[model samples]
Target: MAQPPSPHVERPGPAEVRDPLVLTELKRAGVWAGVVLAVLGVIYLAEPLLLIIGGLIFAVLLDGGARLIGRALPIPRGVRLVLVIFLCLGFFGWLFWYAGTTFAGQFEALRQTVEAQGAKLLGWAHTHGLVDEDRPQMVTQQLVGSVGRLTSALGSAIGVITSAVLILALGIFFASEPRLYHRGVAWMLPLRKRDFFYRLLERVGFNLRRLLFGRLLGMITEGLFTWAMLAAGGVPFAALLALITGSLAFIPNIGALISGALMVAVGFSAGTGTGVWAIIVYFAVHNIEGYVVMPYIARKTVDLAPAAVLAAQLIFGALFGFLGLLLADPILASLKVALEEWAGVDPHAEEGEEVASPE
Candidate 1:
C-alpha cells in the first residue's frame, strides 16, 4: 500500500565512511592501531633503548657528583666534572693496582663455590620432597641453561665491554650540556605541551639526583659495615663479599637477595659456623641500611614504594633482560614525576608539607 516503491538509494557503509561522525570514529581506531604498532616497535628495539636509558642514568650520577663538588669547590662546572671523573678513575686504578690478582683468584673461587652450593641446594630440595625426584636433574639443567641465556642476552665479553664504553661516553656527553639536550627534546613537542614536558624533565632530574645520592650513601655504608664486620669475624672472602654487596646495593630487593646468597654460599665453603655468621652479617647490614640509612635519605629524596619498584623490575627484566632490570627504578621514578606533574601536583612540595586552608 506504499505509494510507489521508494526510489532505490545506495547508502555508504562504515567502510565507505563519508560522515564527519564516522570519520571521527575512524580516527580513533587509527590511533589505537598506531599505539599497538608503537608498542611492538619498542619491544623490537628494546636493547638500544635500554642502553640509552643506562647512559642517562650514568649521566645523572656524574651530574650529582659534579653538583656536590660545586658546593665546596666554588669551581667552574666543567672543572668540577673533570675532577670528579679523575677521582673515579684514580679510585679504580688504585683498586686494581692493589687487588687485581687477588680479585682474579677470588672470582674463580667464587664461581666454583656458587655452582657447588647451588647443586647441593637442589639435592637438598629433592631429598626434602620439595622438587620432584624424577625431574631434579632436569630442574638443575634448566637453571644452568637459564643463567647461560641471561649472560648471552647481555652479549659476549667484548660486546659487554663495548656497551660499557658507549654508556660512559654517552654519559659524559650528556652530563656536559644537559640543557642543550633538554631544549632539543622540548623543541620537538607541541607548543602547548612544551611547558609541561620541561617541567616534567626538571622534576625527573631532581628526583634522579636525589635518589642516586641516597643510593650511593647506602652502598658505601653497606660495603664498609660488611667489610668491617666480616673482617672482625674472620669470614672468608671478606673483601670480595663486601665489594659484591656494595655494588649490588645499588639495586634494591633483588640485589640484596643475590649478594646474600653468594655470601652465604662462600661462607659455607669455610664451614657451617662461618655460613651462620654470614647470614647474621647479611641481616645486620641490610637492617641497618634499610631502617637507618635509607629512611633518613628517603625523607629528602623521591621515596619509591618497594612493591612498585619490584614489580617494575620484574616486568622490565622479563621483557628486556638485565639492562632493563638495572634501569627500571629510574624509569619508574621518571614516570612517577611525570604523573604527579600531570595531576597538577607541585613538583617541589616537601612530603608532609601542609596546604593552606580557606578561611
Candidate 2:
C-alpha cells in the first residue's frame, strides 16, 4: 500500500524572508552611513574642539606609554614621568636660550652688514638687471615694514601665553587620570561590546603613539642633518635654520618644500657658490631622508597614503586654518583605521587572495 501522502510543510512567504534580509541589510547600511555623516559633521562643525581634544588625548597616551616604560624598567612610574616631563621642558628651555643668544649676535652682525653694504648691494643688483635702482629700496622698505608689523602683532598676543599654559595644564591633568576617562568610555558601551571598544581605544592609542614617535624621530634626524650640512658649508644662522626646518618637518609635504626653499634663499643670500652648495646639501640630505629615514621610521608608524593626508589637510585647513593642517595626518589615520575595522578588512593585507589546491 502506498504511503499516505507526505505531510506538506509550508515555507515562509517570499515577502516574509526577503523582507527581513533586505531590512537587515538596509538597517546595517543605514547605521554605518549615519556614523560616517555624523563623523564628517563633527569634524566640520567642531574642528577646534576636535583638535584640542585630539591633542590632549595624544599627550595623555604618550604619557601613559612613558609610565608603562617606567614600570617595566627599574625606575618608578612617577619618577620616570617626572624625568620625561623635565627633559622635555629642559630641551625647550635650552632651545629658547640658545636661539635668543644666537639671535642677538646675528642681529648685530646682520645690521652691520646691511648698513655697510646696503647701497653697494643695491647698485650691484641694479647693474646686473636683477632689479631696478628704485626696486631694491622699495623691497627693503616693504620688508622692514612687514617685520615691524609682525613684531607688533606678536607683542599684542601676550594672552596667547596664558592660553598655552591653560592647555598644558589640561593635558597634564588628562595624562594623570587617563583611566578615569577610559572607564567612563567603557561604561558608555554595552557590556557585550565593552571589550571590543576597549581594544579599539588601545589600538588608537598605540597608532597615535607610533605616529608621534616616528614623526619626531624623522624631524630630528632631518633637522640635524640639514644643520650639519649648513654649518659645514659655513652658512650663517645654522642653528636657527635647523630649528625652523625641524619644526616645519612636522608638517609633512608643505613643510619640506618650505624648508628647502628657505635654505636655498639663505644660500643665495650668502653668495652664489654658497647657494649652489646649499642646494646640493639640501638635496643630498633629502635623498637620504626619503630613501633611508622615512622608510625605516614609517615601518614603526601608521601607514597612510600621502595623497590622503594632503587631501585631509586641504579640507581641514579650509575649515579650521593652521590647526587643521597640523592635525590632518593623525586625524586621517584614525579615520582610516576606523573604516578598516568597521568593514572587517585588514588595512595592511596583501593585494591578492591565496589559491587553494584542488583535491
Candidate 3:
C-alpha cells in the first residue's frame, strides 16, 4: 500500500515572522548594538585606516600612470612599472639633493616674509581706518594664538615620519599586486552578486584614475607656468611660490584661491608692478586650466561640484586631520559610484524615463 503523503508544513516568508514581538524587539536591539560596536571599532582603527587610505591613493597614482605609459610603449608592464617607481624615487632624490639646503633657508625666509607682511598689513589697516588702532595688539594676539593652537593640533594628529613610511610601504605593496587586493575585496561580497561588484570596482577605479590624472596634470601645469612667469619677472621666492601653488593645486576650488592669495601677497611685498603681473599671470593660467582644460577632461571623466568637494574636505579635514583632507575627493567619488550602482540610478538617465538605458 502507498504511504500517505507527508503533512505539508508552510514556511514563513521573510516578511512574515512567527516569532513573538518581544523576541523580534530583542533581535532588533541586538542589531543596533552590533552597529554601535562596529562604529566604535572603526574609531579605534582610525589611525591605521588613515595610513591605508594614503597607501591606496598612492597605489592608484602609480598604477594609473604606469598603465598610461605602458599603453604607449612596447615595453612590458612590469618593466614599465619599475621604471616609473625608480623615476619617482630619483626625482625626489634629485630634488632634495638640489634644493634641500636652499629649501630650508627659503622656508625660513618665507616664514619671516609672512610675519613681516602681517605686521605691514596690520599697520596699513590701521592707517586706512580698516582696523581700530587701540585694539590692534589685542586682535593680533588673539588671531596668532588661535592659529598656533590649531597648527599644534594638526601636527600632532599627523604623528611623524614613521606614519609616512608605513603609508609608503603599504602603497608600494598594493600597487605591486592590485588585482589580488581586488579579488580579495570581491570575495567578501555575496557570491551571486560578485560579478556586479567586480564591475562596480572597475568603474570606480577608472573614475578615481581619471580624477587623479586631471588633478596631477593641473598641478604640474600650474606649478610650472607659475614658476616660469615669476622667474621671468624676477619675483622673490619664485621657487617656493611655485612649489606651494603646485602642491596646493591638488585640492579643488579653495586650493587655487589660497595659492592665489599667497602669491598676490608675496608679489605685492616685492612691488606694486610685480603684484599686478602676478595677478594677471594667475588669472590667465587658472582661467585656461579651469575653463578649457578641466572642462574637457571632466566631460570625459567625472564632473564633481565645487561645493560638494569643498564641503567634503572641510568635514573630513576636521574629522581625520591631514589624511582626511587629502583623500576626501576620492572617498566622495567612490561613494558616489557605489551608490549609483547599488541604487540602480543611471547617472545619464533622462528625467521622464520609466526604465533608464544602461548605456
> Model 1, 63-90: lDDT tens per residue?
9899998889898999999888788668
lDDT score at residue 50, model 2, on the 0-100 scale: 51
Using TM-score as the measure, which candidate wins? 1
Off by over 4 Å in 2: 1-51, 57-61, 64-68, 104-156, 159-163, 348-359
Give the alpha carbon lDDT tens digit for every residue of 1-359 in model 2: 87875569666765674577889998999999999998888765663475466557556545855766766788866677666667666776897788787676775664554444465667788999999868988978986775454333123456345435555566666676778978998888788777666666666777777777767877898889889999999876677678878888777776787678667766766888987987997788678877887777666656776777778877766565555667777788777766655555554557763222111
For model 3, the stretches where C-alpha displacement exceeds 4 angstroms are 1-18, 132-160, 346-359
Q: Model 3, range 231-268, lDDT digits (tens) per residue?
A: 89777889888988888888777678878877877888
lDDT of each: 0.83, 0.70, 0.79
Poorest 10 consecutive residues by lDDT, candidate 3? 350-359
Candidate 2: residue 4 lDDT (0-100): 70
- Backbone clash count for every predicted candidate, in the order shown: 0, 0, 0
- Between 1 and 3, whose TM-score is larger? 1
Could you tell me which residue pairs clash in candidate 1?
A: none
Residue 164 C-alpha lDDT in model 2? 50
What is candidate 3's local distance difference test score?
Answer: 0.79
**RMSD of candidates 1 onward, in order:** 5.3, 10.0, 6.1
Worst 10 residues of 1 by lDDT: 350-359
